[model samples]
Target: MRRLMMTMLFLSFAVGAAACGGGAKTTGADAEGKIKITTTIGMIADITEQVGGEHVKVTALMKPGVDPHLYKASQGDVRKLEEAELILYGGLHLEGKMTDIFENMAKQKTTVAVTRDIPESQLLLVDDGSGTHDPHVWFDVKLWTRATETVQEALSKHDAAHAAEYKQNADAYIAKLRELDQYAARQIASIPEGQRVLVTAHDAFGYFGKAYGIKVMGLQGISTASEYGSKDVSTLRDYLVANKIKAVFVESSVPKKSIEAVIQGAAKQGHEVKIGGELFSDAMGPAGTPEGTYIGMVRHNVDTIVKALK
Candidate 1:
């Protein structure tokens, strides 16, 4: 009887242990057969989903309003990344704070930088001696096309069986981006040549200006950590008065106080600078919204800039 009870107790313990172990986390391909993908930002996730189609399941670590510059991965994020078959992130230090983490994961997993293959000649320099290229490539439709292609290629290489489908989806998406580029150019052309200037809270529009034929001025430098100089603000105010510039815009991810200060400074100098519509900078719009999509966000920005500056 003692041996029988001991055997029964061991069986009970084994059952409980197995049940607890079943809850251990897993990633990559599940029983459903989808290739699990993880991206650091929604923009990457958007393209990955568009190109990957039925073959991949994508999860983005950063939500709509979250700033990637300072975002730190939590334990949950680490688990998701570890479990993913392929992890994508915006390169050139866009995920500045998470750089070390990305580097470490690359050794153990198939990690890709969406902007890795973009030619250095095509990149804008930081000019602050950082020697790093701009990470905000998504702001320009033409430049963003390269990012899309990179995502498609990464997905294809990992899952070659779906290569043709990825290529097809990528072609469709790139065509849409081309249309967006043309639309932006057309809208910017409507603004009087001399008045085609975009002033914003930060220097995030360098790529936008280069691609769309508008001159961009910002209160802060490339990174938000850069100081906002009072003398710089004063100079911009005087320039606005001299140039008769009527509007300045704010960014969704950046605070508006600096821009408000610019407006007030311009007002003191007798120049009426109106608040143009808000622009999506480091992030896109909310999920399920038009601006949430890459094309939609670009269209919204172009329309807002043209309507205000025209």
Candidate 2:
């Protein structure tokens, strides 16, 4: 449905923009001697910057607290995409509105999906029975290591002069990611075995739970757009009651209403569920904050969950 809408607007928007065109001004590395990379999500942009180091400049389309599931490409964003020397995005329709544009760009641009480096077998199938793989691979640090590999290879391929530097940066970044995974394991294990359940606004953490041994429950389905019926709320409320769960989390990019509703429903049935600290699900934190970085976001989430649930 989103692709269909983008298709209708693509030709008109492209033509109009070209007719009245003065492109975005280049700066920093793009002005100097570095590759200019544009990405759809902060996680992708963060990895690109880390792996490419001083050899690349990255511009991310979606900002903090922006929901990528419903994000549309603005004219400025499209111009950035057109001007970039390379493009990186999460695949599996994570950027639902921009999928078609990315597909059309492959012929003329160096567009890469970071998630493509991971084998399809390792990705989780959405519970919607849609036959589509979940796009939140970054939640699992080990899986995210695959994404950094693609980032490094793309940077090296585009700038052969800096290939060795890119590889070195990638190696260092991968080591940090492994350490992050171990930290998450130790923190997650701190929660009592009887209270090892996580409830959140949506199913963005399926991979996180599977990777960390926490049982995750979301009030809504994989995509936030998936409708939840009265029965869905009641079923989760029952789960909370049966398991003696105490906290449900809200996502930075998603609405808290659904999770709040679960909290209310749980309260009605004698289980008082508190709002766990916000988790950076579809997006990262602000630019300067610790949660803004991928590793920092993971650490914050682990610490938050453990403090609240343990």
Question: Each candidate: what lDDT?
Answer: 0.89, 0.90
Worst 10 residues of 2 by lDDT: 22-31
In the range 95-196, model 1's lDDT, one tens digit per residue, is: 888898889999998899989888889899986897988788888888789999999888888989989999999999899889888988889989999999
Identify the runs in model 2 with alpha carbons over 4 angstroms from their true place: 1-29
Q: Who wins the lDDT comparison?
A: 2
| Alpha-carbon TM-score of each model against the true structure | 0.91, 0.91
Which segments of candidate 1 are over 4 A away from where they belong? 1-22
Q: Per-residue lDDT for 68-121 in model 2, tens only?
A: 988999999988888888989998989988989999878878999999879988
Error of 1 at 202 (Å): 1.1
List pairs with backbone clashes in candidate 2.
none
lDDT assessment of candidate 2: 0.90
